[model samples]
Target: MVSAVPECGGPGDLPAPRIVTDLAHGGRWTSLTAGGREWLWHRDEPRRAGVGPGDPFADAGGLEECVPTVRGTPDHGDAWSRPWRRAGEEESVDCPDFRLTRRVSAGAGRTVVDYRLTAAPGYRFLWAAHALLEVSGRARAVMTGG
Candidate 1:
């Protein structure tokens, strides 16, 4: 499914976020209402081949790289699972194309990571790989799907 990037936020050496470029891609996860949740952060550019623009939101069962979910192991094909929580900086793991950086804030109890839809050129669009929080049965998920 091929598409073009709108002229409004055309693709280029895309502008970087004020404090960090991570937000321009996805964003930081603040609070988790549940053990699982999902979100989509719009990109200023266009989507890539694997992930098309205005694409639907994906959970644990969606495409491997299209979303971010905790797994028991680091395997790409593994299912989502609970991750161990520690402190301080973390070691780096290699990914095929995507570049991910996870930084846990000891002061704020929040995490920030940089996410990209596709590791191709001239491609940018809304990235749903942002921080996702699952809510309990009684809670509700609400967002203006604009």
Candidate 2:
């Protein structure tokens, strides 16, 4: 569920900004536009091992290792390949150990995203929001915190 509001701009700009989601691929947001500019980064094809282009759940963030092997979850967990259900401006999926939902809304100058996750009681897990934004030419990322 992704949405965007277009701002006044010059020619070639879209009448409205919009977001495109890929429900089959971890419900990843493949596209985002504001003021006629794309904000999210994506590749035409996969460029690295263990991840594909536009994968929102690229690493699974250790959830696969935490869960029992009997479940047989993949290295990146189930979200990456699971098909989600859509109802209006929301998309959701239920996995073997948890359920996740995502909603997007548009405002005057920004888009807001909400993610919800529910897991069984006592199910210890680690998760990460693996979203990436594209910038012009080259970019760098700094990580802080343990």
Please give the lDDT score at residue 121 for candidate 2: 82
Q: Write one digit per residue (lDDT tens) for candidate 1, span 1-146.
A: 11111112113533221111122112222222211233222233233222322333323221123222333123221111112121244312223433343443221222334332334675332223333333356867668976
Off by over 4 Å in 1: 1-88, 108-127, 130-136, 141-146
In candidate 2, what residue range of length 10 has the lowest lDDT sum? 61-70
Let me know the TM-score candidate 1 reaches against the reference structure.
Answer: 0.26
Those runs of model 2 whose alpha carbons end farther than 4 Å from true positions after fitting are: 1-17, 46-73, 138-146
Backbone collisions counted per model: 10, 0
What is each predicted model's overall lDDT from 0 to 1?
Answer: 0.28, 0.55
Q: Write the per-residue lDDT of candidate 2 for residues 1-146, one digit (tens) a residue.
A: 33233343334533344666766545656676765577676665442224542344343221111112213445445565565678877778777778877786655444566877788788765555445676767756679998
| Model 1: lowest-lDDT 10 consecutive positions | 1-10
Model 1's lDDT to the true fold?
A: 0.28
Pairs clashing within candidate 2: none
